[model samples]
Target: MKATPADQQELLRLQSIDTRLQQLAHKLGALPQTAPLAELAQRETAVRGTRAEAIGALEDARSELTRLESDVAVVEARIARDTDRLQHTSSVKDVQALEAELASLAKRRSDLEDQELVVMERVEDAEVVVSSIDLQRAAIESEVAELEAERDAAAGGIGVEREQTERDREVVAAGVPAELLAFYEQRRARGAGVGAALLRQRTCGGCTMTLTGSDLEQVRRSAPDDVVQCPECDRILVRTDESGL
Candidate 1:
């Protein structure tokens, strides 16, 4: 294929633009905050699980405390009724029985009260555990929000750069011969992202292999407008004064 020397050089500019676009795409995908954000997501899931368990424990403790309070209330009511009867009793035998019953009720009430206190302490501890877990979850959420904001900002910048680079590519590519550009695109797809390279110092810039003997002679014999390819990498070889012929 024949392309003017000037058009051939434009291929290098196109390649540079394409390479920059590729770098920008890679940067977008590999933002520094991406991995940490994923890790924080996993951490948040685990933390939520822990928080759910803590909440369950707190609910259980509160339920137990309620039962204990109810038992204490019932015992106090019985004690009050027994004390009233003891105060109004006429017979000595009746008075003794009432006093004995009142004493039993008092002991029962004391035991229930003790148990209620213990359960109240457990409820308080459970609540503290839930509250601490809440704080931890909130911290994780905050960090996640910050990381997401950073990731979005980084991606937005890359997107803008990519759009500009693509526009530059379009303008550069429009100047290239359609047949030559198509061939270049095909080579780029089949091989590395680079489709053309400078032949500097007798070396194939695409593969970095020095041309010698017949290969060097062949390139020298070719017309200036004749497209030449590197024997090593099959990429279009763009020659200039630095080609070291």
Candidate 2:
């Protein structure tokens, strides 16, 4: 807006600071560790572990139930064979032995049936656990999807802001004189903040140090159009009305 060369340079410096501040603010707002996606990933991992344990338990229960059922079948077969032998036996001793064998097989069959029942109950419980874990895993998957969407949105928004900053930088660059722009860029690359500072109350804003009496006098006597640099920080110093010295 028709600013003097010094005022324009100051504006450019201010713009540069504002741009960096905008980027820093965005970065602070969008930290990866604190993002929703990260938390969702952690929850998904826990749910998956639980699901795996539940599945393993179910498989073990099924295996035990199978073994118990096989044992029951074997005992029943032995009881049948002993009953046939008892029917055909001629001696009282042989008959007694067959009866005893049949009784033992019956007891074994009963025991195997009880074990089978217990295994069946455990299988049912494992199935319930697996079902519960599956539901939980599904829920976590939905949350992960939502978090990924949010992360994508945040990234898209940051991209837009970066483009806007680039445009603003171009505008600021155009207003700055070529030689001055080169000088500012060089100093900025060397770690100076914007390569310019405002002089206020006889203090160099770049370094926040007050100038010596003679240097202060010299600055005051210099033409307004002349560009001056802070001795301590080597930054282009713009004189402001608030400079007391």
Which numbered prediction scores highest in lDDT against the true structure?
1
State how far residue 165 of model 1 sits from its true place (Å).
1.1
TM-score of 2: 0.53
Residue lDDT tens for model 2, 1-245? 12355654555465465548567566846766346667777887888888898889999999999988888888888888888888888999999888888888888888888888898999999999989888888887887777667666767766667767677777777777776667666655554445767788888766898987778888888777777777777877777777775
Residues 101-219 of candidate 1 have per-residue lDDT tens digits of 88888888888888888988988999899889889889989999998898888799788888888999999999999999999998888666999999999998899999999999999
Model 2 scores what on Cα lDDT?
0.74
Report the number of the highest-TM-score candidate: 1
Each prediction's TM-score versus the true structure = 0.55, 0.53
Error of 1 at 139 (Å): 14
lDDT agreement with native, every candidate: 0.90, 0.74
In candidate 1, stretches whose alpha carbon ends up further than 4 angstroms from where it belongs are 36-148
